[model samples]
Target: MTSSSRALLFLLACICWVPVTAGAGERPARIVIDPGHGGVKEGAKGPGALREKEVALQIAHRLRSRLEAAGGEVYLTRERDALVSLTERVEMTNDHGADLFISIHANSMPTPRMRARTEGVETYFLSASASGEAALAVADRENSEAPMSRAARGDSTLALILDDLVRTEAHADSSRLAYAIHPRLVARTRAADRGVQQAPFFVLSGVECPAVLVEVGYISHPEEGLKLGRADYQEKLAEAISEGVLAFLKDTRRRDAARPAQVAGSQTP
Candidate 1:
């Protein structure tokens, strides 16, 4: 961005806040849920032949139902085991003017030992660089299926990312959204809290609203994999995710509602 454009964005950032309303409140929350990996990308398989793609779809469907029941207007990127490009997913979110965008997938490890030992729930919001090596690895594998657009890559990428973050205030909101949801997931599922991290997730790029990617559990984990394949467990996962999303939306509304008052108070000096 040029100096003028940067100045404009910075000025807007000083005055902007997007309030998230409840589905049954003033407006319904428009949510886009993406079930990652389908078609040729079968993703990982577990000891019982449980597939990541299948598990993700199951959870997505369950999540959709729960959100709709709660009055949120939810849209799935792919309703079934269908392949959806990363670009298409972003387009759908933009087209719907979504309040939130969440991509769901099962986690996996590269080796048997790693698979056996690693089991937990993880959540992520987008960033220019990853929080650490492990988070970067997760982002890399997930991004490998679809390379990011040229603008999202290359040496000038950091500048571009910062520009977008400043323009949208999405980075800050996305982090808050992740923090609100991660704990509920761990509490509801009784899964290890793998903790939240930020990474350069391709699918999360360019989303107009707060976006997050959730790694529900390790599909390669012997016990967790079996649990993931079960209907009851899938329901639990869906229930937890829906609760988190709704909670975040409500919290966003509360936070934004107070923001102007805080700003006005600060200006009184």
Candidate 2:
């Protein structure tokens, strides 16, 4: 069967069943999953009739399932085939006080005739500007022409004044989270292991927590696209991501616990 048909079948199967729930008194880690493109805006297209929106939604659902099964509190930016603005998506995560923000996407290349050999996992953290080609490509896809005021864009002097506040706070954790998960993803995919990097992706910029935009694999790569469309591959991909997230959370908690205690002892007489 064609990939789209297969994806539809998979989605139906998920919908038909009730998701397994977690045990009592378990405080699941809160996660916000953003399915890349939706509604009229089909992000990218590939061979075997793979649309970016379709794959993103499918992956987001699967990812949510994986995270929830591991006792994570998961929320999706878009549950169905509908358009959600970037600004709104960020606000949702921020408002919900989500622990992490993960925007799921599939990649497409400019050159259609480019060979199908390119395959890998690329994860991105927030940055002020793109330093390279991979960064540029991600930025270009995400920086859609949604209308925004000059102030919000940091085009005004006052906005620039608070830039440091904006910069120093959230993105540090985001970078650390990305670093933690990326290597695990590379190891699991066993594809081209493009290491973690920073870029000015709109999706990652506004959130006030650890955030990442995951380009799981190049859908334009014919061979990889076929693999991505399979249920087995999807399960493996979700499993790897889950493992990475769990490891990161555990390590972070331990590191936090190791810091020396501040005792207000021996006050001046």
lDDT of each: 0.83, 0.74
For model 2, how does the per-residue alpha-carbon lDDT over 168-227 read when each residue is reduced to its tens digit?
745677777788778877787776886787766767766878888888888888888777
- Residue 3 displacement (Å), model 1: 65
Off by over 4 Å in 1: 1-25, 148-152, 259-269
Error of 2 at 259 (Å): 3.3
User: Model 2 scores what on Cα lDDT?
Assistant: 0.74
Candidate 1 lDDT over residue span 6-28, tens digit each: 99987754322222234234677
Q: For each predicted model, how many residue pairs clash, with residues at least 3 apart or on different chains?
A: 0, 0
Residue 196 lDDT in candidate 2: 81
Model 2 CA deviation exceeding 4 Å by range: 1-27, 115-117, 145-169, 260-269
The pairs that clash in candidate 1 are none
